[model samples]
Target: MKNWNQQEVEILKSKGGVIALANPYDNLVTTGVEPWPPAEVVQKLYQSRQTRAFSEEEKEKLQKFNGYYSDFQSIHSEDAITWSVFGTIARAQIEKRNKFISELFQTLDLESEAVESSEIYLWRRIPHPDNLVPSGPEIDFGILTNDTLVLGEAKWKSSLGAAQGKNKDKNQIQLRVEFLQKYAPKLYPGVHNFVVLSVGLNNDVTENYTGKTVKCISTTWGAICCLQSHPHHDELQRYLAWKIKNTKNG
Candidate 1:
């Protein structure tokens, strides 16, 4: 049987009084997963394009919008990394809370790949000055098969606030909502019906503060309340207590 130790580790990180990660599979490259489709492919595709075919005037017009294509090209080919702890520590928090994303992917029949990398930050568009390209996202989770596409955002934060240093406190939930509405039906011609995950929390995450303002999408900034009621609460509690005992003995 596959050890659920790593699974439990993610749970512990989100819980109070539970510290230190459990190495379940003994895998290196902890907390980061690189996505498939290497970057070289993207570079080659960009080179093969016949830029000469377009007039200089047309090229200028396109260059103005190069930010969109540049990012698309880079993401398509770059190695994607998702922080295992930051992305989705408690899969149940997402899968169990939102039946729509769970069923949505099931319908698409795409096997979800769990990546251990920081690239998930990209997918989540964790609020950052440099990451304004994607902004927040209307939808953060998705299933992409050979041809089909289904996308949605999952919200599991404790509360809302001014994440970007702005005095205006924006509900973190709304960031994902606007993302899909802004990009959907336009970025990809075939993609339709975007979805967002609306999570609720009964705890105050802002009680703890850092020097700088943090964005809501940053999984690290997610509220503990989001993880408290999660189905795996008992399992996590058990695992951490056991780990603490073993550590003291050693």
Candidate 2:
């Protein structure tokens, strides 16, 4: 595979940002793949099933299964391209765990003491804090070290939510930190939250973590895309380039 030059990366950062981080259904459409059944169709099907439900157990199972399916579709659809990029990087990290993570941390400008082993886990849908809250928000990506828990939310052509409301309540990142302090003490004692955007023109990606509330650092998908330039990642690089080219042409 040809080496990716700065020019190519810049082009991708500009024209291919949307394609690189497109929703799964949109990705398929961009690539000329067939669209899924419409939202109304799926809703109608679910409603019909609900109208002729079976026993309590069966109904519970149906609802659960439907929810699971919805989540599956969402995960696959919403962040398909972003996941593709991260998934390839994860695979490479598995091969060169220590080196890969060290470089990755540096790329993201993460300062750490020391970690014996690290793990990268994706698609974390943290449970709600209390019964009052029906559902909890999700962490787009996570990196777990021996003592540190780094969670990141990635955005493309969208602004990160700084605060939930004008009243100045905790922001989304702060809420996650609060949850970790309350619930995930044993799992991840230390937490770091970051947000990666497609265009990080004026965004702050610096370390702003303090106390139990970690300030979210903003970065760009293009910066992380640079990590996939290794020879071992040739296949993924080629694939991404090919897709980006197609997307641009279209």
Candidate 3:
């Protein structure tokens, strides 16, 4: 029997937990898949049905058929681990920026609301999107909505190294367009934007990104921005405005 003690619990877990084993569907990891481009990830999954850890019978099933797909496995998938690390750190930085920006703006007593609703996911690791959803490979960060879809990639570094491995050739960033084309077609139903934020620049890389209708942008916080949890907004004009003491200084 499939352990009726936790049948209900296992059933619920079984619904989707399989990916956790095969793909580690860690949603919030919530950031980069590899030093290389996430689009490079390509493989077929192989396994017998039934979750709750591989059982003897399930192992037998895998060996019984033993077809090409049977042995199919991801020996080297995209660095889902790195992506997860990047996402978690980057989102935290975003929150920090939001706070700093909000605190700075609040002092002026401005009347504007910044929505704090956005999800970051460790997306690129999946062989395919969860439950065969119509999502795409704009991984690292690809969130979609009614009007606009934001495809974000977060790059991180310690800045302690003499050299860093960034897509200096602009290869991965360039492939992002293709990543969109292949992974999540639905996100591109209409308009979209591409964002690449790096902690530091690679040793010999140039910043050359392209797309016809895509709006591509980078951050002002320099490449070392990763080391700082919170970043000052790069608008020197705005920073200068804040520099002069306001009538109210807390």
Candidate 4:
């Protein structure tokens, strides 16, 4: 495996950008926030994880500078993209936030009813209904309202992961849907929405995951970047635009 720091440095170079340092802690090159978002906002998002226990993998990842939670230098990181986009939304003024959410729902063909009141949580671990795994899928982010839950899986240069160990037949989406159907309601008590947010996706995902009980909607990071206009969005938009361009050219 490539050193995570080197991977990010290469991605930045590929975009015709340069970095003074290759380290995540020093570079803070993310989807493009400099030195990260406001300390309070980042702290609140981090604190949300305290609501539940983390798996050993999650705990270890949290400790590493290049791991998802601490990573801000990687342009190819899904967590970096997720935090930059939604973290900005989390701190936006209510009107602008709601407007952005409304436009996002319309773009994804989802109902707009919950846009105004939803709460956003990042990297939340939902327990498996079957107890077959040590921990269930750690959702990239979740938008929750009184009657609706939107679980998002984000990608930049990667594809959705496959099931490991004993559950080889199911893909990550299937596992997430299983949680959405079997366990989500007991915790959130709402209509479920499973969204695959990516630059582009394989057809197999849509063909295999969409069903009556759970709807798997596919949308791109570029589409999301287009949904809002805010000063805070400038860096993230520029970063995602480069990613989308590169993804298409290849």
Clashing pairs in 4: none
User: Candidate 2: which stretches are off by over 4 Å?
Assistant: 1-78, 92-95, 129-134, 161-171, 181-187, 190-215, 228-250
Tens-digit lDDT track of model 2 for 1-250: 1222322321112222222211112232122112444332243223322213234433344344334222112211324444445543444444465555666667667675455676765566676543226356566667676555666665533355664523456566655666665666644545443322122323553335556334345665445546644323544354445544543232
For model 3, how does the per-residue alpha-carbon lDDT over 29-116 read when each residue is reduced to its tens digit? 2222234323322222334243334454443333433331121221112233233333333345556634543442243233335625
Ranking by TM-score: 4, 2, 1, 3
Taking every candidate in turn, the Cα RMSD to the unseen true structure, in Å, is 17.5, 12.0, 17.1, 8.9
Query: Each candidate's lDDT (Cα)?
Result: 0.31, 0.44, 0.34, 0.54
Per-residue lDDT of model 4, residues 84-180, tens digit only: 6776676666776667766767776776465647666677777764574658777677766555567777765566677632447766677777776
Candidate 4 or 1, higher lDDT: 4
lDDT, residue 236, model 3 = 23
Candidate 1, residues 161-249: lDDT per residue as tens digits? Answer: 34532333444444444444555445546544343322222233223322221112222213322245334434434433343243222
Better of 2 and 4 by lDDT: 4
Give the Cα error of residue 194 in candidate 3, in Å. Answer: 3.3
Residue 182, candidate 3: C-alpha displacement in angstroms: 7.9
In model 4, what is the error at residue 121, expressed in angstroms?
1.5
**Residue 249 lDDT, candidate 1, scale 0-100:** 21
Count of clashes in candidate 1 = 18
